[model samples]
Target: MTASPSSAYPYRLRLPGPITIPERIRQATARSIVNHRGPEMRVILEEIQQWIKPLFGTTAPVLTFGSSGTGVMEASLANVLAPGEKVLALVHGQFGERYAQIARALGAEVDVIESEWGWTPDPAVIAAKLDKNDYRALVAVHNESSTGAVTDLAAIGALLRDRDTLLLVDSVSGLGGLELRQDEWGVDIIVTGSQKALMCPPGLGFASVSEKARKVIERDDRCARFYLDMRKALAVVDKHETAFTCPVSLLFGVHEALTMIHEEGLPQVFARHKRLSDAMRAGCVALGLPAFGDQATASHTVVVASVPEPLTGGAIVKHMYETYNTAIAGARNKLTGRVIRIGTMGLISEADVLTDLYFLERSLTALGHAVPTPGCGVAAAVASLS
Candidate 1:
């Protein structure tokens, strides 16, 4: 059982994004593609509009784009930022840094306030920065996937409530799994992808826009834009149309995914994610791999742990994939080869978490790392799930 794909054709996707799609959602995606501008497509878009609102906790228009979450991140910046405008970015991990980069690329003078990897930025610190200087917007990641650290969006939003800065959040991996009251939190814009907690395949990006953000977008004409322009997207939102050609198959999958989520009920859906997160953290800690970030603010969507001494994250990831047909992800950039991330988002269940922990324990022991007990990790996971 070398690191080869011998019989791993249908192996589980335990990574953060591009999660294992449920059978029904896959079947929906396999259905024949429909015309993008047809009556059927219009109805699908209309239903999506209704289904996606509660996920973001917003009644504001959620503009969809035929791109990844990164595309919508760029769209959010391109729409509201004028050239040479000063923006403040709170950075903690890879995704947070990417948001800052997008702002800089859009010609905004971005001032980044960074925290150590695996930890979230403090809201008080953000408040201090905002009070000291005037920024056009404050950008942050609702969930830092690389470190499995979830930011306190509501707290951060409270700081900006009295300020003039717009609250732009990248909830690509957080929207469905975590609690996000976009409008209630005063979040000006929220960008998300279909792949993470939504249980759909990639290729669809969404942005929930508030009136304040819309006003900034409407006034900004400094950046060059065509397909990513929010004004054009908003204009046709009421008509159930997109400015560009839509990904009809992906939309079908999203519709099915949202239906499943709705059937489960939003509160239950969030509780499920919280339960999964608890189980994953317990299992990993029992295996001598404590969570990498602040446990108090750990993300419900993914669990990250630093690999133990005398073993590399790559070796563990490889062993799990090659020997057990399981797939987990390693940390990015600064923490590369140091930590492993296990996703608890989307359609993952208790059985799946237990199986993952069982194999993960095996992988650790096989890689010359000692496990405290033979079945302790799985046992702890069971206890947490119960």
Candidate 2:
């Protein structure tokens, strides 16, 4: 299924920003599908896995699955954790809360360290919890997309270095968009999806497992879910492949995307995301909207902003879509109707930033909401970047 540029809303400003498929990926997919278990496919899978390791800053094997980000989340729990094991689950937003639910459903004893939706959990608090508990694993969402907050994985890793706790991280939105040092941070299992900063369509899930986690899983005799077993997945990886049918299209896209990322240089890619995020936040602040996440814990991909009392987030979104032809994400759950999320990852540019700010101001004014001026947001963004 090729995406047509013309099919996109002509005048609509895409707030979520669209996925970018490089020419190489298109050509790769154009090749006839081969047997996934064959040697040729095995070589491709190995190369993809090798390419993914550096992106996660880990030398460990990265397991690829034909599933969504949630699949990896489920796999992490089912494979490494046995029923009745104790886990420290940190909850700062919707994604973090998911770990708590998944862990509980797996019959694990879950101890949660809850923080406000828009704030990050203090590393000290995480350390305190680890100090008192003999938990089997510590689970955290490195970047909470729902709240646009980034947890300090390095600090959390430091806290767990002295302990026997396995650090499991959900970095679905954090991996390629920000600076993530998985091996350096001592993360045991790190998970990510293709749809975020990887610049690919959704459906591919990835996880890099540490040697320590591998040993623990190897020692456990419990049977994991057939489809989500990490041990079986690793066994296949040893043969340079997956246990089940993989999403060939998405894999093709990932392979191409990684090449594009390499060509651009990882440091430059990260800087681009950071610059776009800063521009978006500065634009919002200039328009009188407050950024939702704590400045210190802000993510480079998405920026959550509180809508003014008189101007609802929905109204802003609607105006941007109908009038300006721009799309933006709304708040999730408790934050619904209260916040607007602007994404700054994958194929976004300086022009996109300025255009978004311009339309945002116009949309607010058209909806009878207060905004500073026509170019105030753009000006503020420029000044912030300077």
**Best candidate, lDDT:** 1
Which segments of model 1 are wrong by more than 4 Å? 6-10
TM-score of 1: 0.97
* Total clashes in model 2, counting residue pairs 3 or more apart in sequence or in different chains: 7
Residue 137 lDDT (model 2): 87
Cα-lDDT of candidate 1: 0.90
Candidate 2 matches the true fold with a TM-score of 0.93
In model 2, pairs of residues that clash are 11-325, 12-325, 12-326, 13-325, 13-326, 13-327, 15-327
Whole-model lDDT per candidate: 0.90, 0.83
TM-score per model over all chains? 0.97, 0.93
- Give residue 314's error in model 2 in angstroms: 2.0
lDDT of 2: 0.83
**Alpha-carbon RMSD, each predicted model:** 1.5, 3.3
Model 2, 93-160: lDDT tens digits are: 98999988998888899999999998988888887777787988899999898899999889888888
Off by over 4 Å in 2: 1-31
Candidate 2 Cα deviation (angstroms), residue 202: 0.9
